[model samples]
Structure formats: C-alpha cells, structure tokens
Target: MAYKSLLCVLTDSDFLEAPLAQGMALAESQDAHLDVLTLGVDRSQNGYFYAGADALMMQEMLARARSESDDIEAKCRQLLQNSELRWACDSGVAQIADLGRHVAMRARFADLVVLPKPYGPNHGTELEPTIEAALFEGQAPVLMVPEDAKPITAPETICIGWNESAEALASTRAALPFLKAAKTVHVVVIDPPVHGPNRSDPGGLLSQFLSRHGVRVEVDVISKTQPRVSDCLLRHATDKSADMIVMGAYGHSRFREAILGGATRSMLENATMPVLMAH
Candidate 1:
C-alpha cells in the first residue's frame, strides 16, 4: 500500500460539510487519491476481548455500527466524486469496536488524513466520543479543519515546531511531501532565551534544502520569551493565520519520563488547528 494517498473523514450528518470540502481540496492539491471514511464507533476496542465485551453480542453490535457508517460513507462519496477525485467508501468490511484501530492501521497506507476538528465548544455533543478516539488512537497525521471551512490548499504560511525527537522527525518527514509542494514554507524556531542553540534548526536547514528544489522559504526565529514553546507555536500559528502546524511528538519510556519531557503531550492538549504530528 502506498502511503501517498489522502483520507477524508466524516460523520453521519452534514453539519461538517466544510471540513469534508477542505479534505477534498487538500487531497487534490497533493495529487493524492482520496478515500472518504465515516465511522460509528460501538464498543471501545479494549472491551471486546480482555474483560469487557460479551462475546455473543459482538457480532450484533458490529453489524449495527457498519449499518450506521454506511449511509454517511455513501453520502460522502457522492459529494466528492468529481473528475479529479478517485474516491471510495470503507463501509465495506468493518466492525464498530475495531474501527479506530482499523483506521489507524489503514492510515499507515495513507500519506495524510483530513479530519473534522473533534472538539469545539460549539459542536454537537454527539460527535465527541468518536472524535476523541480518532485523535489519540488513530495513527495518522490529521488535517483537522474548522466545521465551516471551505476547500483550500494548506496555508501559504506554514509553521513547523522543530525539536530533535522521533515523533517530530516523523512529522517533519511526513510534512516534507507537503512542504516540498507548498508555495511557502515558514520555519519557526522557538528559542529558549537562555539556550545556547535550538537543536534541530529545522526551519533554517529545511528552508535552505527546499530552496534548492525551487520552494520559496521563509524563516521566523522566535524567542520563547512568553508562554512555553508549545503555546508560542499555537499563538504564532494563529497570529500568522498559519494553515498547518508541523511538529514532533515527544515521549519518554517510563511513566515518570513521559510526563517530564513530553512536548507532544502539550500540543495535543492545546492545539486548536490542523497539526500534522508523526509519532
């Protein structure tokens, strides 16, 4: 499976038509094949085996989830089947309990995913749980959009939070396909006032590298004087009207370490826009 295609996510209702449209636009801009997926999560995957789900009831529950997802999947496909799109629905073979995992597994084959912003003070309370699962459990870089947004190329002003870490590197690498394709790439280096040097310097280094390939690069060196770097990035992205944020996910082995130096944890907690994260 090629990890170069785009995946669009949807709910059973049309309240988020804007995100669907943007997802389509995102897919077309990158010359990626588009796959629209709608999910109706039944039981959490955890409950199905170890100690929760009733085995005899599993098949029935899975069937109902598929039935619910089917209509939305069909509607999404109809809405996006113009000449430019090669679209399909995954309401084909699935189980509700495993939908999140399946989406994550299949996302390995996709270059990116266009997801509706799972949280907003204004969205219907009904969609929250399903969205939450995708945010944490789905293993893809999500291009989350506003509920009312129209289709668009990723913002010309792109902000990448550069840190020397695996998740960040994965995010950087995943974003390269887009970065190389973007009209403008802004590398923002948030500097700690007391620091000697920021480790990665991704914006500077990547800008120079992409310039050789004809991409227009801009660099914004910021001093992390106010708020933490994570919050600063969010503020910068909003202030610049940055279309997307690219950054690494920071993680540590033990429970103690995970809390001590996890920037990804911070971003995931506070991010309010389409953030491309790779872990």
Candidate 2:
C-alpha cells in the first residue's frame, strides 16, 4: 500500500543535493528503506573507437569519473548516517549504454525509483536514456525530481493526467501512496475518447476507485480544444497550484516519439514540477 523500498539515482555533483535530500525525506516520511545509487560511466572501450585519440585524456576522464562517483557515495553515506530511516549506498561502473540497464535491473526490486531530469544533450551526461530504461525496463514508477526540487514537503494537491490507458492505470495505482495522503486529487482527462468505455464518463471509474480508498478525488475534463496534451495537463496543474503530477510514461513507441513527438517526452523535457510516471 505504501513505498517500502525506494531507489534514488545520483548522477552529477550539480544535481545531487536535491534528489538525495528529497529521497531521504520521502523515506523518512514513509518509514521506508532508502537506497542511494551512484553511477560511474565506463569509458574503457573508448580506446577501441578512438584509437588515435590521446590516452592521457581518456585516463584523466576515467579518474575524474571515479572521483565524482566516490564523492557522491560518501555524501550519501554521510546523509544516511544522520537519517532515522534505514538507508544504504551502492556504486557501480559501467559503459553509458550498460549503465542504464544496470540501474533498471536494480530498480526492478524497488517500490519507487527517483531520478533527476536528464542532462542536456550538449552537457554530455547521457543520463536521459536511463530514465526510459528505469520506467520501461524496470517496470516501476519513477519519481523525477527537477533540479530545483527542494526538500520534500508532502504534496497537498496532485494532478493526474488520465487517458484510461494501461499506462495511466499503472501510474495511478503506483501513486496511491501519495494520492491517499494528498488533500486534493484532481483526475484531469484532456479530450476523452468520443466513444469507448470511458467516453460516457471519463475519469468516473478511476475517481470512484480512489474515493473508495478515502482519497479526496475530483474529476475534471478539459473539453476545450488544446494544441498539445502536455500543455493542457501543465496548465491545469498550474491553475490548481499542484505540487506534483502523476501520469503514464509513454503511450506511444519511444522511437515514434523521438521521430515525431509525444506527451510523455514533452512532460519529461519541460515539466517544472515533480512528475511521477509509470510504463
């Protein structure tokens, strides 16, 4: 019924404090076990592709990576030592592509996975792919904390982007812990299907289900046309002063979204608030 085990991925020095603090706070609140995972990118294969490149530069890069990973692990240990909840730290070194799989595999045993927004492509972090892997491969709900996400406060108001898809249902169920504690739960359905099981009463089924759990649920349908689903969801969240958003991770193929575009990708790229997503 609640998060009993939470995984928080630590990537960069610039982004560590927020997620670390947020994860610890959530663990404390739920009386859950917190696992801090620090990642170090493996670049040993780089020599094969860039045979002519300077070996010294690659060595320096690997050393820096190790140093940063150690720093993050140390910080996590220090923080965990002062926390009341059970906590542990784990560190690993893997190639960029392999790292995602590693994290996803670890996430499989967790109740909730926490990650930061992907670093900008130009920034060279390559942590974005891990987000997708964690959501889809790990088959778990992901709580993405924005860089600006401060120390966690229980969300009083939460907005759910509902479409009645399996993805949406998974996210809603995964978010029950938060929804049950929230003062207000708004199930916003943007442009519901004209004819389907939910056509007649979009959000009706889910709203009732939540109410049964003692959640203060409200259903809101945005009948007005909107340019993009993400825009509508964000606008509704803003209007309601929502602290967090719960929604499906990707309703369409990741490749198709990358080639075209999708709501999940839009939210991941632009959401200013914390987003809890599941695939």
Candidate 3:
C-alpha cells in the first residue's frame, strides 16, 4: 500500500530541479529507493533525408544530443552525491516518437512514477506522450509535479474527481494509500446524472466505501459553475486548501480529448497543484 520504489523521468534540463527534489523528498520520507533516468531524444532516427547531401547536419544533431545527455547525467550525479537516500542515476537516448515506450519499459518495475508537469509555462509538450505511456502502458500511478510546488512529505487534504467511470474507479483505488493518510478526503462530483443507478444519492456510495478503510471521507455534489468540469474541481480543491488532487486520466479517448478538450487535458494544462492520475 506504500510506495517502496520511485522512478523519476527527466527529458531535459529546463525543469529538472523540482522533480528531482520532489522525488528525493518522497523517497526519504518513505525510506525507499529512487531511480533517476535522463532521457535524450535521438535526432538521427529521422535523418534519412541527410543520407548524402546533408549528412554532416545529422552528425551535428547526434553529437548535440549526446552532449546534452552527458550534461544531464553529470548534474543528476552531482546533486545526488551528498544525499543520504538510496538512489541511482542513468541516461539513455531514444527516438522522439518512441521515447514513451522506452520510459514505460523502465516504469514497469517501479511502484510509482514521478514526472514533471507536461503542459505548463515551465515545461514543453514533449513529455506528454511519455506521461500517457507510463499511465496506460506501465499500469502504474503517475504523479505530475509543478515547477514551483512546495515539498510535501505527505498530503494533509486530498480531493478526488469522481465520475463513476472505470477509469475513475481505478484512480481512486490507486490513491487509497494517500487517502488513508490524509486528514480529510473529498469525493467531489460535478453535475451527477439524474437517472443513473445511484441517482438518489450521488457520491454517497464512495464516501461509505472510503469510511470502511478508516478514511475521514465526505461527499460534495456541486453544480458545474464553470465551462469545464476541471475548473470546478480545481476551484473546490483550492477552496479546501487541499495539498493534492487524485483523479482518473483520459476518461474519454485520447484523440477525442485532444481534439475536443476534456477535463483531463484542461487539468494537465492548467493545474497549479500536484496531480496523481491513473488510467
């Protein structure tokens, strides 16, 4: 029920400090082992066009990638050398399109996957695919940490975004450890259906289920005041001064969510707090 092994995946050096710090703090708190992976994108995978005319350009790109990887690995080792936590640092390069699978392969052996916020002012969109791969392919919960997030040994209050879908159930189950440790857990449901099986009482079943596990749980059924469900959830969590939010990722198809913009996309792009998600 507790995280014993944590994996931190870093693609570049732009927002490395926050995730590394967070991973180390969590590992120290849990007395667990931490593994840091510095992944570089291989530009030579798509250098077919430079076979004869522009081969030197491709070589230069490959050399740059190697240099970046070496720099990141050195930085990680320097930061982790003085720490008393059990940790290891490794680096690898993969094609941009296949980076997700490579990350997922390593993630399969870890209890929890720690990653930088894929969509934010401090991060680029390159990590989005890797996050998805870890969530779906690796079959492990993913924690996305913001660049300016305060270090937390454990969350005091948590909010769960509920929709009664299989994905939501999976995330809720995955977050039981945190819920059991939190002082209060809120199962927030927005605009519940009027004709579902639990129409008479929305979120009550979940509250009861959590209570059986010694969690101080409550249910909040609120109307959707904002255009998107994610906005309502974030506002409520902020109002409650919750330290973290746990919810399912991509309730809808990824393609549909990307094209039409679902709650998952909105939360990934705009959330200021740490979000733990599973598929």
Candidate 4:
C-alpha cells in the first residue's frame, strides 16, 4: 500500500515554509489526506501564580502570543486554500512542550509525519523536542525536510544507511513503500563491524530482503576513515543522486535534554535531502 495519511507539524518559527510546501506536495503526489497541526502558546493558565506586577507582564506576553498564533493560523489556512489537495487543519494552544505532545498524539493516526529540520545550535528556534515527541510518542517514521528542499515528489532514488540496528530496521520497513517504487535502492554500509552478530554480511541480508519485495537493490560497502558515518552516508547519497535517506535515529539519556546520537544529529543538521528516521 501507500501513504494514505500524512501528518505535518507547523510552528511559528523560521523553518515553516519548506515543510509546509513539501507536505502539501507530498500529500498531493501520494493522493493522501493531509493533516496540518499548528502550535500556539497559551499563557493564560499562568495567571494563577502571578502577583499584580507579574500578572500585568504575563497578560502582555499572553496577548503577544495570542496575536502571533492567530496570524500563523491564518497564514496556514491561506496556504492550504491555495493547494488543491485534500487537507485538514488543526491548532493547539499550550506550552511548547505540551504542544509537541498534542502533535504527537495526532501523529499516531498517520501513515507518515512531516517536519522541518531543526535549526543548528546558535540558530534561533529549536524544534527537536517536537521531533522527538513525534517519533517516540507517536511511534512513527518522520520525514525531515531541509530549508531549501524542492517541492516534494515521490523518491526515485533512495539510500538506506544500513547498520542492522532495530531502529534501522524500523526505518527500512517504514520506507518500503518508497523503496518499492524507487528506480534504485542503495544499502550503504560505512565502516561495518568486521565480525559480530550484527555484521553477518553487512547489507547483504537487507539487500536480499528488499530484492524479494521487487526492489532494485544494491549493497555498497564503503571504507572511509576520516569523516563520520553520517557524513559518509550523506556523501554517498549525493554521489548517487539519491532523493531520500532512510536511517535509524540514535539517542541517549540526558537529564532534561534531548540528546540525540551523533550520526542522527549530524544527518539532521547536514542533510540536503529529506531524511526518513525511525527510533
């Protein structure tokens, strides 16, 4: 089957346009129903804890947030109106953290979720929490669009960063629909383990599995020493003119922080093409 339902998360941040356009384009290409979830902050609830002075300042903040939210909502509606695709729009008013959870809950019903790649450190807004929420809470594959991405289209060439991790398997399975449709599927293994349970012929098993699904699969083993695995993966994708990169997301424990795996973070920061990840 195909992606019959797609969820897109929108925010009043700098990274909105590309994902908005891509989401609509993707939904149109797949003939899928699109759901757009926009987030707004509601500070009214903070009134219970505020004194006279604090209450006045809080009211100003709330007013500003409300105005911003309204404008963003209108913009989203206008964008959707311009598109002929089947779409629905929903908005939530909550703290940013809770807003992410709300989006995640809605994402559970979707076949795929679309999001804008998080800005690099020093770049203003942060959206990784939202991405994390959607991936973990929704338990779904996420398609992250770069700021300069072209209008979405069905991927013709796909690169799978193979490591045989459970997350990688989940990503591959989630990407099967695209792989089966692609003209070429490259399973790229970088600096694979020489001998281990996970290294029983790196990429061979996955290639075979994909071949059985009628995909034109090829296994590529690259021996690179300098750049990181994530860098090599991106290089391979570029060299092959891949339209999409499907891989696993890595994460670790961080007290009150969303600390992502090195490879996953690099891919999110440096990828010029759409990266599909599952954790």
Scored against the true structure, residue 14 in model 3 reaches a CA lDDT of 81
Query: What's the residue-level lDDT of 164 in candidate 3?
Result: 92
- The per-residue C-alpha lDDT of model 1 at residue 201 equals 51
Top TM-score model: 3
Cα lDDT tens digits, model 3, 1-279, are 778899998887887888888889989988889999998776455644444646677667667777877888888899999999999999987667677788889889888888888986655455888899898889888888888887666789999999998778888887787889899999999999999998898988888889999999989899999999999999999999999998999989999998999998899888888898989
Better of 1 and 3 by lDDT: 3
Off by over 4 Å in 1: 1-4, 11-16, 44-63, 82-84, 92-97, 121-140, 181-183, 192-203, 225-227, 250-272
lDDT of 1 by residue, 141-243 (tens): 6665656555667467678776545666567677776676667777777763344454445355666766776667787878776656788888888888877
What candidate 2 gets wrong by more than 4 Å, as runs, is 43-60, 119-124
Predicted structure 1: lDDT: 0.63
Q: Provide the lDDT at 141 for model 2.
A: 92
Using lDDT as the measure, what is the rank order of every candidate, best first?
Answer: 3, 2, 4, 1
Q: Give Cα distance to truth, residue 34, candidate 1, Å.
A: 0.9
Please say which candidate is ahead in TM-score: 3 or 4. Answer: 3
Please report the candidate that would top lDDT against the real structure: 3
| TM-score of every model versus the real structure | 0.73, 0.92, 0.94, 0.89
Better of 3 and 4 by lDDT: 3
Clashes of 2: 0
